[model samples]
Target: MDTQSITGATAAEIADSIRTLHERGELRAGDALPPVRELATRLSVNRNTAVAAYRLLAQAGVVVARGRAGTVIAGMEAVAQEGYAAGSVLRDIGTGNPDPRRIPDASTALAGALGRPVLYGEPVIDPALEQRALEWVGADLPGRDLRITVTSGAVDAVERLLAQALLRDDAVALEDPCFLASIHTVRLGGYRAVPVPVDVEGMTVEGLRAALAAGVRAIICTPRAQNPTGATLSPGRAAELRAVLADHPYVLIVEDDHFSMLSQRPYETLIGPEHRRFALVRSVSKSLGPDMCLAVAATDPETAERLSLRLSPGTTWVSHILQRLVLAQLTDATALQAVAEAGRHYAERNAAFAGALTDRGLPATAADGLNLWLELPLEAKTVADRLMRRGWLARTGDEFVLGEQRSASRHLRLTVHDLTDEEAERLIDDLVDASR
Candidate 1:
């Protein structure tokens, strides 16, 4: 289409016009949009108007700016998800799931959860869970005023937190090779994602500074056992980040401690005592089971109040029965012991896999999470393709990545804790063969 064809008086009008063209198949994916100055001249609007229009489109994931390459329409594929890929016959090692055998039996918890019926207008949080959660989560928080809010899972809590704190086109800083759910949440919420690189000690200081300089309104950090890479925030790095964030006290900082109970590393936080907006979320999925679908969020009083508005009575409040069941398990000595054993089990299995790969010269690091982020000499896709032929399905590091970090794609995130000894040995041999 010609530059004159893309007509609008305001940013929203221009954005709507472009979206209409996309819907009618006139502006297809990868098609370049006119430059801001050219578009402004053609539309008889200010250059800033054109910029705002493009920014709106970008936030909605309609088009991407490629610097010298200019802005082009983005592909509209469904967001990638975690868990098992459908119809794959190979022995899948990239499911990102905890071993089912390690999950504590919730039968007893369920029985305990069966109590008097809860009514509307009653407090949403289960009393016991709330009390235990405060003591558990409050211990790490630097802020004195902590209020807990319950959500479906870590993803749900993140989505809600972002929605409550930011506008559609506001910028949110996310780790480059971020968690799948976080990427999807930012995109689907129509917010701009500024990529922050993650290194061995979690999010790098320089990367975070750049993101903050870019004017990000919020940040989602994985403090312990970051997804895919298994990198935890070091104490030094955490302190550096806190010092950096100290200047931006009003920006919303969310710490998703998904592997809290199951992580082998010590917890390090970015939220400072003086910071005004922040939340620390702990989900029971890793230690208890995914089915529990519960996370406890400790946030500033104002943020908690805002979250409560979204999770109001007789509406979006999480199920009391579910909360009670999780509480039952948390308090049960046997279940707690099982959770500890599961943590150890994941560490041992991942370490063994990493050692096996290292022995063969790949030099893999086990870290803390369930998966091994193994870097190889060959391209991960090439190895994964070869592994598929040998009855395996592995996830490449690119799947979790945000921006152009192709070098990081050489690594694979494999879940091998549930594999039998023979299966583990076979996988090691097959991985070596695949790398060649």
Candidate 2:
């Protein structure tokens, strides 16, 4: 099959032609696609048009760009599974979930939201909710022209934001040992993930520069309580990142503050005053409950306009009831107190667990978030197997790695907040033994 002969003038037409070729099995996985210049010349189209076509194909998970090596058909990308395995008898510490006991009951909030009928063509965001969100998120952002938009959750907001700004096959900088949902979102969208190594002070400066050099068009960063690593951005680190990003003003930078209300650490950001494209997302899933399915997205005017297109009436809008419920929960004095208490509980429990592990010579620390990221002496998989034998389930660090080939990761992300003192002690003992 001669893929070089494939031709179309427009991006859609070119993308369709290439997709058809793949669907018909003429171009299988790993088959090289014509370079942008060659394809443009052959089809009598501009080079940008060919680039756009390849990007479309990439967004559709059809092909991947390999820099100087050129673009090639991509194999199916893997999506990580979240939550717990069904019917598992083992104590599942791997599930990165907030304690059910801590999630505030929304019965009263639901009752309040049911007072009015929300009809179609109404405002996408409730007026009161929008004002409250603006106040809450605006105080933390560095620039003016901040616009508030609501989405189902952080994952949904990220998907829409990326879709709005980037074409498929466009490189997106993501943190190594990233959140599972972020990893899944990037792969499913067919965007090539350029990894930026994250440290105790959040994303590394060298890593961001490297990703930028790789021509990454967007970046997804967790400002605080970064999943798996639980790394928060230090003021110094945030300033350095902002300085690096200043040169790349148009790169879409998304900050997913998923642990917003639940984090003990203060919020820091990479979006500078002059940065053109940026978004900060805060989900209430951890504080209220995952079932709330609500997140507040604050972005620049243009990104907000683009995001609103998908959220416009007659297509899809967040249910007004859910919005009201979230608003009610946030506004209610009693609920706010409960949320504060929940935050402290998570911090204390995780800190206690980490301290216990360290005292036993394990050298662990719960920096922030619902889980403790422990570095093991042995390979994670080996320790995982040993843990399974001890009837405890944990998530290995390898599942969160991107663009790196380490022989093995000696890390595990375990949620120890809900465990009792005895339970934690037993698990710690088991972990210590497993690492040996």
Candidate 3:
């Protein structure tokens, strides 16, 4: 098969050609595809047709974009996983995990959580859990016509929310340097992701306007303690975003407040009073435990109805036992206190690490989450290699980046909240040395 023979006029035809090439063993894994402009010129098609073709291949996991490195056939590990790497000897400051000691003990709650046996025809959501969730999410929800749906996790809720409102290739706005799961979800779902940049005050007004102008059908935002950067939405910024969104009333807005119980920042939402389509999802995965896979999705009545279609009987539904268990923990006074204390614990550790970095002249800031988003003066990979030599494993910011920002990513998202005083001090010293 001649490489020059790879040809097609339409995006779908081009994608099919590549797939056929791969199937026939002419294109192997890690094979480089032609640059978009060059491919467009060769195929006598519009440049955008070539770009869309590559995007189709990417969404189907047939290829991957590596920034300036260009696009290539992807291996199995294209999607990044969270938490510790398997069988690693280095001190891991990159695993974005909560302190095990902080996760409230569910054993006692579990014993009582198993209530009466639920039949298939029964309501999916536990009644007690529904009331508790109503009180919890209702406090912050702007619209009064809120309906709750329980899903496996925040990720599940986001997936369903997007599925309910969007079709394949529809534009959806997502934060640049977004959460790994969100990036994977959008790509795998075959939706075009419009990157909205985040500053210290959360998503930028200009970026959101651009995405709206691009006709995004949906938007996913993190109101407080946004991942990687820990960028929280200021009241002023939230108001600005709401105003921008006011004109596009029907655009589906999904807020994943993953750090709801653990964040020290105040909750500020983008959903204004007149916003018609919105979903506010909060999960116990962070505050309770990852094993406790349950999230309360407070959504507009119509979206709830549409999302409920997927959660119908016999197909899929969150276990009532799991819901009851989470409710027990949520209502327990002692467990509530533990969650609060864990929030303080994370804040203190991150702040101390930030101070250490500042004293060493790195000048990092610890805002309001379990991780510190440290911008390095040196390239992330260069500094990561140095850190590796010193027996530390760190995640670079590029892994979380989307769109054109990947090449310029020089930040590292470090989970140092679980580090002890001695380990923290040594890691800080090692980081300062690594940057040099």
Candidate 4:
């Protein structure tokens, strides 16, 4: 240890030293370093100097402090995972993944529907598809005269909802670290975002109240399969939300149930019978296929009427052929079964990886959704970059944050896919190393 007073040293020097040490393998991810007192004494610096140094590392996403675990390096200088990055690079870890091998044999469904050239002005979303969508979603929804309106996908539905329910500058409450599309949807629409913090039980009631008091007029929440954190709202949490919104009857509440059909957690409806204004949206990208780009929006009658005006003139109505294909596949018992099986496969694989991690003594794997919500001893982005270097890419929590103080989290979002036991083990080992 160099006995040099860091009090007079610049922030850049401390950062440079940390980076150099990490690159030279003098420090490894998750490898705890000496305490601030020890490091400061060894470096002949004041305690504040050492604290500042560590703070620099944390800001740069180079290290983290885990109380008694002490301070540890944050991400890998090397190592990666196997999956595909749909854009930018060919990372091995897949995003928006569907079990390709598990997709319902589209051959029969496609063939049956491919023969017709439906004329323009046909049902933007085929009626058959809408009916099937209603049935699939209706099982979970009750008492509100629900009507289904299909759109290009979940994002499309969100955009349309925002267009109809809010105007520019209106405050829309969002989960603190929300889904990427949700963040983009609100921001692109020029709506202000009020972030509500989320915890294990899902969106915190206090946070929602704060946002409501702050005067947010619209809200978008994921009842299940919330992206990034994979935090699902518990029944109690839902009830809490209903209570908060009970007085704010005018707020436009939109629940994006993207993973409704495939969620591993038990279904819980956020809409209480007396809650008058709300919409429930679900997309089939993960289960049906991303290319299908179909999502259904079930809204209150007034909202439905307003949305219809937005839909009337444009081809924005979903394509008839595509809608028919979705309907055709959805109505088939075999196709539906295949989709169910695919969901099970995702749940199983994700659970396996999470279990493997827990079994290894890191037990924070219990959660829902398609990806593993992983908190590393390292910064989430650093782990992702390291994984990328090793030929894999994982989503960092930052990508989903909609707050003004947007910062990276120590959590990584990974979608587990077809991997042999050996591959899974290797992935975890690499992650452990990458975290180091």
For model 3, state the Cα shift of residue 5 in Å.
Answer: 10
Once superposed on the true structure, which residue ranges of model 2 sit more than 4 Å away at CA?
1-18, 24-60, 64-75
How high is the CA lDDT of each candidate model? 0.90, 0.90, 0.91, 0.75
Give the backbone clash total of model 3. 0
Q: Give me the displacement of residue 357 in model 3, in angstroms.
A: 1.3
1-436: candidate 3 lDDT, tens digit per residue: 3357677889999999999898888988888899999999999999999999998888787888889999998665577878898899999888988988999999999999887888889898888899999999888974478899999999999999998888777899999879988998997787888999999999999999999999999999999889988999999999999999999999999999999998898999999999999999999898898998999999989999998888986568988888889999999999999999999999998998999899999999999888999999989999998999999999999988886768667999999998888898899999998998
Q: Highest TM-score: which candidate?
A: 1
**Model 3 off-target regions past 4 Å?**
1-77
Q: Give the per-residue Cα lDDT of candidate 2 at 94.
A: 91
Candidate 4 has an lDDT of: 0.75
lDDT of 1 by residue, 1-436 (tens): 5345687899999999999898888888889999899999888999999999999888787888889999998885587688888998889999999998999999978987979998988999988889999999877874478999999999999999999999877999998788989999998888888999998899999999999999999999999899888999999999999999999999999999999999889999999889999999999988888889999999999999999989987678888889999998998999999999999999999998889889997788998788888888978899999999999999998888788875458889899999999999999999988898
RMSD after CA superposition, every candidate: 2.3, 3.8, 3.6, 13.0
Per-residue lDDT for 1-436 in model 4, tens only? 2223223354466667767777777766777767888877766667887787887776556776677888888753222222354366634554656668877777788767765766666555566676777777677776678877877898888898888877666789998778877776775676778999988877899999999999998888888878777888899998888887888887888899888767778767657777777889988787787788888898888888888777752557776667777777878899989888877888788888888887776655647776777887867778888887876666776666666545657777777757678878877877877887
Give TM per candidate. 0.93, 0.88, 0.88, 0.76
lDDT value, residue 148 of candidate 3: 94
Which should have the higher TM-score, number 3 or number 4? 3
